[model samples]
Target: MRRHRHAKIVATVGPASSTPDQLRALFLAGVDTFRLNFSHGVQADHAKVHAAIRDLEKEVGRPIGILQDLQGPKIRIGTLQGGRLDLQAGETVRFVLEGADGDKQAIPLHHPEIFDAVVPGQELLIDDGRVRVRVTGPERTSITAEVITGGPISNRKGVNLPGTLLDLSPLTEKDRADLAFGLDLGVDWVALSFVQKPSDVIEARGIIGDRAGIMSKIEKPQALDRIDDIIRLSDAVMVARGDLGVEIPHEDVPARQKELIRACRLAVKPVVVATQMLDSMVNAPAPTRAEASDVATAIYDGADAVMLSAESATGRYPVEAVAMMDRIIRSVEGHKLYHSIIAASEPGEEETPPHAVATATADLAEAVRAAAIVAYTASGTTAARVARKRPAAAILALTPNVATSRRLSLLWGAHSVLTEDVDSYEEMTTKARHHAQDEGFAKPNDIIVVTAGIPFHSAGNTNNIRLMQI
Candidate 1:
């Protein structure tokens, strides 16, 4: 079934919603994609979910996207003696290379790479920024830091280095293994976590090599600096804010989110605003006011998709979370301001025929109050170009390649459908128009804008546009 809203929803599959019934409920609740978080589940676990999803796809006759999120070099604290330690603000604590029984004064940090790069003035955030530390001394393989924001730091809590760029590869051994499994499963997208540079994208792209789309998870500060290059190399980008909020100041997260979204929009690449969108809904049936607004803000900013992590993975209300986010996105897109905001991000082009035709199709559709902008694409380029214009009408993309149709789901305002390959513009036009009518995008005598590449079945050959009455 087609989603009423333009923005897509990506829901993570986990213990809370891994069954056939649960997964079907999520898909029916408007989840356009299913994320298999490799950090927690094994290949076998995901294989079941993947099979179930394919089964649902067959039942519904819709192309569903699957994203495999690879966990990168994630560092965590060593086991504490009591499993918990309270650090007071301004207290000096020592983190050494050797794992040890940790107390209020000392903790174990076996990752020497962190100590190698940390200096006397840099800050370290422990336990997701709950306990912040300012490095006061660096002696050999140990670091002495005074707590800046103290709290109860639990065993194996994550560490975030805001300023120091650590010497680490984006892909870890575990991530490589996970990537192989996901590619073998034929997942549509593979998201590399903790990306720090463009070379990371190069490395992942090298391994992926057209097997799947590479999505760089932008969470670190270094990734922010090399964002344009990373976006250029990546098939898509994910604004992963869990660890990002830990490194960057909380007050800066909103602005940073907007900046990244804007960059991806200009690049014509799909970006997903992820992490804790409806986190409170993980337990409560209803989302918090701020959380609901947070999701709407992303949609307003023209994010291609808004994601749900724990809210759908281990949450008690997975279906409710998806339905809630779908409602919020639909509501926001219906607002008058949402139209202006997304339209304002229209891309500037060098004025080629394909670009000219794509723009004209959007403009013509709006001028005629057409049912939708129907795009017949092979590589999804023409549809992407049209979607970047953010037309008032829906973007209905018809593709013969199922993979292209699946990947096109990530693009904002592009609702992809799979159909048989056609030969001529007339055939493409007839197919697109009929499909729009069948999909309820138009009725008899209704007008719709149709655009396609001149060389049928060829990539990036869009040069023709026409208005057809259904």
Candidate 2:
């Protein structure tokens, strides 16, 4: 199942699309990766869905990527009196650090981290920014704030603290348990939510080790301050515009999304533009024109992938959403300006031999109009490096590790296949030609570019290049 477009699609599996038949339809509809969101489902539910995806993968004869998204700490207000509260603008409300029910005069904020970190002037956004309060007084055990945007709020509504850095771990107890379970189940990637800084990525990596790739989701304004460091530490990045838009200005989300995509491309890491790409499609058979443009805009910005959250997870038209997203990507990539835009945004190469070789592979592939660029990658780094260039030729990634093949499914322009290790130079060329033809990337007499490292099977040492006629 070779995808026609360069960018990949990640669809979340949920109640609407958990069955084997549903998953198989999604995969056939151009969903390159499946996201198992731990935020809503129980472990048993996720296990059954995971098993179905694996079964579908074997049936389709393709390595499909499974991303386990760990729900991070949930910061919310405690129970309220009457289970609800309505306030007007310019009114003062006191939020106390207690578990007792609160009336209109006082609201209970359960998390101690907020009390410790919040200061005067910091805004507390409740229920996804529906009700905003500016902290006017920060006492030892309570905070008094003036309502800037007033609305109805109920028990356990989520709280977003803009411009406040809480000294809290990104991973809660539940996330740790969920991470272990997903790792044991052989997830290819783990998308960590509630990331504030690079340390969060480092912390997740400590537990993950080499078992799975760690994807840092940029959801807080704090993450933007040190985005470079976070991108460097992460194997992939996600522009989680939902929570991020709530924390920052809505107009700023687009700029942040573009910046994140460019940063990820510079780092040679896969980046997925997620959330609300096809929200209207969740109920309707087709997406709004604005939503279609949003997905296309991400493609034009050189994002590695665009994701579907509720649109595929709980949407009524899961298959249609995937097909629509696939069509949008193909249309954008086929646009005449697509190539020039990607080339113009290409980051400067690092001053290293491996990087230089990767750049040359792309350059030669385009110069000779080769059928494909075949990369032998044991750790998938070689494929990522070549993909960063966004070459015209398709990327045929050959790896001895099935995990590498599965992970490469998220990368742009990478058609990963499982293959045996090459012990000699001739063996490498023969395998490249055979796989290129076998994968429909090349035919007899068609030219192809091959890249690998000397003393084969060495990871991260992409030092050789060869041009071959298949």
All-Cα superposition RMSD per candidate: 1.6, 1.1
**Stretches of model 1 off by over 4 angstroms after superposition:** 103-106, 350-352
**For residues 1-470, what per-residue lDDT tens digits would candidate 1 score against the true structure?**
78898889999999999999999999999999999998897789999999999899999988999999997999898888689888889889988777465865568888888978888888888878878889999877788899898889888888989966888888888898888888988899999999998998998888999888889998998888989999999988999999998888889999999998888877778999999999999999999899989999999888999999999999999999999999999999899888887777655663677877888888899899999999988888889888877787999999889889999878888989999989976788789878998888999999998898877868988788888898
What TM-score would every model get versus the actual structure?
A: 0.96, 0.98
lDDT of 2 at 33: 94
Look at candidate 1 and tell me the lDDT of residue 368: 98
Best by TM-score: 2
TM-score for candidate 2, please give it.
Answer: 0.98
lDDT of 2 by residue, 303-420 (tens): 9999999999999999999999999999999999999999998877888888899999999999999999999999999999999999999999999999999999999999999999
